[model samples]
Target: MNILRSPPVPFTDQASVSERRSNLLDASTISPAGFAWLMLGISVSMMLCGSVTFFIGFMLMPWVIGLLMVFYVAGIVSAISLLGRSIICNALAPPSPRKHIPDNCFFCSSLGFDN
Candidate 1:
């Protein structure tokens, strides 16, 4: 009996489980009016954070633009390098297998092939 093969132990017994459920049933949940006020508070806090972020970005607009431009150029360079590597790999790869053309095919006959 290794620990990995050991059976799981119950966290709580039946009596304690029933007591906890009874306590939860006795507790009062938030009312609709309280929920509405909670939502209003959350919205106000989010708006305040958003306004602060917007002003900070606006104040550092030039630095932000420069950073964005640098990243855009790096992305373009990476894409071009990836395209070149793929093209080189394709060129170096073996030619594809020859297509099977049936002797009775009309398209092959029109192309002037005996096969």
Candidate 2:
């Protein structure tokens, strides 16, 4: 089902590399300090929630709740790792799932490709 859609514009490759680079998620767009701080905050919050939930489960003596919290913690941790990896992949050269990128672009060039 579609609603309130705008017309699609034609894709063009004639834009300079610098311009296309903005369209892509390159290292230039991220602040490493921000990334580290975000991860740290996520880790701290996850630990706090997991510990509190586990403590409650222990006090209540429900074995299943403890197990559920464990799984929840694991799921969030994995999700965060995956999201981070995907973001990093975007910043990497030879960015993910793009067609018609030059064979001599930064990604290939950084990986030691020469022609």
Candidate 3:
């Protein structure tokens, strides 16, 4: 098994970011600490890989390591932000006063209007 492989995609690569985000938040993908676990795994791998490269005298530049670290930090932060978002979808939204106000006859109701 490839230890370095990223967290399994909850969505297809063909999907847009919003679609993937929604997929990640869906019931099928929701794990209380899933994102946290994935982040931890990725961060640990990054640290280990960077350390090995630096100590093994690979041609890796110090600036590259610094830039990678910055990217890693930003990635983790964005992941946390995404995990904190509400999971509500447009189709699954909570009913509101406006929702029942019947804006479109075709879409607002399933029952045929006599009028």
Specify the highest-lDDT model's number: 1
The sequence of per-residue lDDT tens digits that candidate 1 reaches over residues 1-115 is 1212333344656657666665554443556786688789889999999999999989999998999999999999999999999999999999999997678898878888865
Find the 10 residues in a row with the least total lDDT in model 1. 1-10
Quote each prediction's TM-score.
0.37, 0.33, 0.27
lDDT value, residue 62 of candidate 3: 75
State the C-alpha lDDT per candidate: 0.77, 0.73, 0.67
lDDT of 2 by residue, 30-76 (tens): 46676677788889999999999999878887677788999999999
> lDDT by residue for model 3 over 1-115, one digit each (tens)?
1223344484455778887766445535535477677788889999999998887766557778999999999999998877666444544777666545545577445675534
- Ranked by TM-score, the better of candidates 2 and 3 is 2
Relative to the unseen true structure, what is the C-alpha lDDT of residue 51 in candidate 1, on a scale of 0 to 100?
Answer: 100
Write down the TM-score for model 3: 0.27
Reference-based TM-score, model 1: 0.37
Q: Pick the candidate with the highest TM-score.
A: 1
